[model samples]
Target: MSSEKQNLKAGESHGQCQEKAEEWMQSTKDTANAAMDKTADATQSAKNAAPENKEQAAGFLQQTGEQVKGMAQGAVDTVKSTLGVGDKK
Candidate 1:
């Protein structure tokens, strides 16, 4: 091939390589940004749910405590009646 033709071809190849590199870099940056955005959203959602979860746990514990107290009282009554120590009326 002629020298001029070879030089032209080399320049064209360099241009194509540069374009492909630019496209790859852009794609990588976009993917990283998307991943960061998803992580931020997840963190925000967890922060928002913490208080609600704590309140629910507290409510459940209170309900369970009340049920346990009732059962204990009922057992005491049963024991008293069995022993004939209950109300003498």
Candidate 2:
């Protein structure tokens, strides 16, 4: 009788362990799914924002180019003046 009781207890313990393992696996799956969902959402958001970002960046670059061109022209003018070549109308 004692042997039978030991066997039953061991079986029950094994079943409990299996149940816990299954629960843990399920939790891991849920976490993975949530992470995937969040990643997808972030990817979509980035895609949606890309065109606007590109346009803004292009505008900024154009403005920067204009400023640089102006500065270069000013430098050239300064150099010409320093060389006493400023009388050329």
Candidate 3:
């Protein structure tokens, strides 16, 4: 092949490689952006669920407290009955 023709072909090959590199870079950037967006959405979802979790915990604690109170009252009544210190209902 002629030198000029060889050089032209080499230049075309370099251009094609450059184009491929740019395309790869653009694809990588898009993928990175999508990943970041998904992470942000997940973070926000967790943040949104936090209050609901807290409310549920509070409700559970309240229910547990009430149960404990009832048990204590029953124990007190039983003690009084055994000791004959108070009238049993």
Candidate 4:
């Protein structure tokens, strides 16, 4: 291929990569938001139920804790992935 054609192709490739990165970032943000919302709802439900049902309230609280832990783990994993350092495979 000619030098001009090669440069054009490289530019196109770079643009595509940028676009994909943007999409990935948006998706990550969306996922984080949804996780936070779920955590908030679970916490609220647990608090409201605590006055009415002990067992059910405990379950809700447990769910909320698990959600928080999962979110933390997700954040760690995302950071590792972005830095290209972490689990292999």
Best by TM-score: 2
Kindly report which residue pairs in candidate 3 clash with one another. none
Tell me how candidate 4 scores on lDDT.
Answer: 0.96
Local distance difference test, candidate 2: 0.98
1-89: candidate 1 lDDT, tens digit per residue: 69999999999999999999999999999999999999999999999999999999999999999999999999999999999887877
Pairs that collide in candidate 4 are none
The residue-by-residue lDDT of candidate 4 on 1-89, one tens digit each, is: 69999999999999999999999999999999999999999999989977779877888999999999999999999999999999899
Please write out the lDDT profile of model 3 over residues 1-89, one tens digit for every residue: 69999999999999999999999999999999999999999999999999999999999999999999999999998998889989746
| Pairs with backbone N, CA or C atoms under 3 Å apart (clashes), candidate 1 | none
lDDT tens digits by residue: candidate 2, 1-89? 99999999999999999999999999999999999999999999999999999999999999999999999999999999999887687
lDDT of each: 0.98, 0.98, 0.97, 0.96
Lowest summed lDDT window (length 10), candidate 4: 49-58
Please give the TM-score that candidate 3 achieves against the real structure: 0.66
**TM-score of every candidate relative to the true structure:** 0.64, 0.94, 0.66, 0.58
State each candidate's clash count. 0, 0, 0, 0
